[model samples]
Target: MADPSSQNPTLTTPPPPSSSLSPTPQSGTSELSPPPCSALSFLKTANRPKLRVTSEFDSDSLLFLNKVSCKLFDNLAKLKLSFQNNSQREVSQPQVSFTSKHVSVLYDIEEKNTFIKSNLDVHPRLQLRAIHNVKAQQGEVAMEANLTEPGYSLELSSPVPIGYPRATLKFPLGEISLQEKEDEEEEKQKRVLSVNGILKRQAMNGICTALYTDEELRLRYAYKDDALSFIPSISLPSNAASFAFKRRFSPSDKLSYWYNFDSNMWSAVYKRTYGKDYKFKAGYDSDVRLGWASLWVGDEAGKVKTTPMKMKVQFMLQVPQDDIKSSVLMFRVKKRWDI
Candidate 1:
């Protein structure tokens, strides 16, 4: 045998076991110290549970993700198919797709009518209703549209509060006075002649006696040979005789009628027997009187008749005074409307 220890490879010294050590505590009556600890126990005390991070999903999570992805793919495929079908149909057949959809909300509910609300609150407000009236079909809806309608009346009787101050109108009072002037005395009282004129019987073809009685006529001094010929000046007094005219007429007579007079008519005479007033009437005879002659003519009657009868009318200052002025009073004559 050649070197049996070398051939068998026997160790000169045995190796120590792989065991860990730590500081131990002292156990004594004076100062206590703990026993030494093992490295494996220290490792057990220091090591914590490790967390595993992964990107791969679990079965439940994968199922949810698959469901969502499948739904999205199906929707996209349907949309693409629809678009392709629409494109093909559009080329083959003409179709009118009305994108302008009329909203039914813009209608009058109570009135059961539709209207266009151009400025509606939330909507675009461009709304329109049917032009003609029609019974609403099944599932028809009415909208609140027209706030007002024909024959709709509202009366506001109560007073409302206005944000304004109260207003007032105040007037100041003033005084006024008049002074009278003295007139110079006349040197002599002039002599005057009193003339009395009477108006007599008058007739007409087709006229009412009440029309004549109710009618008013005025006389003015048209012209005179001398300005102060008749009793200085015919000063119309303020008495009833100055402004009023009267006539005694029969039941079959009318006083108001026109007359054509010849010139140079004369009075009966100067009399102090002052009648109430001078009365004029249409004459009965066809004879024509003129100027001052007709003014004092007595017992006259209506003569020639005409279709549209006109009253020979004249006006004078009824109350003639130096200070009182005269003005023309107009009466509207009724005319036939047919012509």
Candidate 2:
């Protein structure tokens, strides 16, 4: 009699809403979500292709060209086009080259020349290299062995076209240590002595080398230190002697002088570098009675290894003391790119 609906409390209570635990149909998602079209368009842009080109220019009378090169196939190959003056040449020369870790091949379209080089790592301390010229139908094979424990190296090279073989041996003599006394600075310098011996086959008499002799043997001694280097060389039978010296004033400044007793000629050069981007050189030759000054705008050798692209510019002036009118001013610009 106490009301049946009041006795059943569960039945009297209203049912809980279904949308409490899950999102409702009209409400949107609460978590972060990326736009559908943005991801697809981003991938398309990232996979797009690109092209790269390199070029060079020169203002000289060396019968050269203004060359441009295009990289392809992930930079494993290059196609080059060389342009020259119409008065000098008719058509541009095209060149192609392919390179890999152990081999390289190059071909010239106009000259119909091909060059191939292969390097083999036979052992940890031994290496072999072979070079072939298609046009000349000639080849050369070279081997190098390094004995690090004794500080000795051996190199042998032989020509396939001709029976000319050569061998060179290099070894360290000893080292002398010296200390400098200064008020505020103390430095230790090492004087390293090394020797080089070269032996050539008798058939190589007609070939030109540093020293020519009937015994086909040459010896050179090198002494190097932190700030000074001296190299004295002599040949057997001919006994032709040459001396070279280099003095370094600082890390960026140096002077080099060399004299050849066999030719009775001497040459000297002074070089100064301004940071890593600029270099200046002045040189004089007694044999030619010529003096030259050169300015380099970039570190050609240093940058090539670390950069994918680089530009180099060089300005040179040559003065012949005997004939001032024969003086020449030359400049060259080179740029390279990798794609």
Candidate 3:
């Protein structure tokens, strides 16, 4: 006979343990723990909106505060307070403005003026603007259209109730390529031509304007390259002409010149930028017989509105050749805060 254990294997082996009674490590134990309080608080603060304040101060020739302005704004609206000091009187003005995705409204307390602007969804390039003076009971409305495909624009404006309307049209003619010969040392250049037409009805009788006749017309030519730019414009009827050019010697140095043939005046300016925050400009004007110099700190490339810096300062000086004793010095300071 076999042994009793071999004959009855079920009795010798112990029964398997149930899964509910077995001991095992928990797989989600780490994930069940809560995050730190500091991390949650940081995330909440970052998503909240904050108010912004901007202050600007300007001093003119008399070394007095010519203008002082303070602005407070948030995501929806803006409020501005300004104080102006002149020779005759002092004035304090308050302004408020509200802005949305497609519409904006502005009001001036001192002047009793209201301005409204809206973008029309019916046309991608159409815009409407209106202004009203409550004290004078006068208003104006303007409509503008931008044709991007043809590089053309049309604007029409008229006074409220009864007034002559003014219209302007601007279109680009074409562009020319000026290529250099293989042996030529000069670089290739491109020139663009554009034209502008203005039609206006006379204020006296409102009958002077004709569809075929433009009250004023102008032709503009522009040539720009990596290091140089030249722009010239000539006006019809009056035959007035003006020219402007800029030359860049380096990434941070440039020289600019402008001349008006009708006025027989000219100006030349040399600008040098150091790093990202400092700029210096020196210039002379033939019309005013003045030589001027200016220095800027904080804002680079003259981008005052978009700079992240908190403070910006500008200092300017003008010396007259005819009367050195009547020289003028001016300065401006701007500061911004987020709270």
User: Which is the leading candidate under TM-score?
Assistant: 3
lDDT (CA) for every model shown? 0.23, 0.69, 0.65
How far off is residue 92 in model 1, in Å? 72
Better of 1 and 2 by lDDT: 2
Q: For candidate 1, write residues 1-339 as lDDT tens digits.
A: 011111232356854644567334355532233335656665664443221111111221121100000111212211000011121233211111111233222233345543321212333322222322233421211222222443222211111131111111111221111212223344564433222221222233211111011123222221122211111112233211121122224433223222222322222211111132223322222222212212211112221121123122222212222323442222211111111
Q: What is the clash count for each candidate, in the order shown?
A: 29, 0, 0
RMSD of each: 50.9, 20.2, 20.7
Off by over 4 Å in 2: 1-52, 62-93, 118-214, 304-309, 337-339
Model 1 misplaced stretches (Cα beyond 4 Å): 1-324, 327-331
- What TM-score number comes out for model 3? 0.60
The TM-score values for the models, in the order shown, are 0.11, 0.59, 0.60
Give the 10-residue window scoring lowest on summed lDDT in candidate 3.
1-10
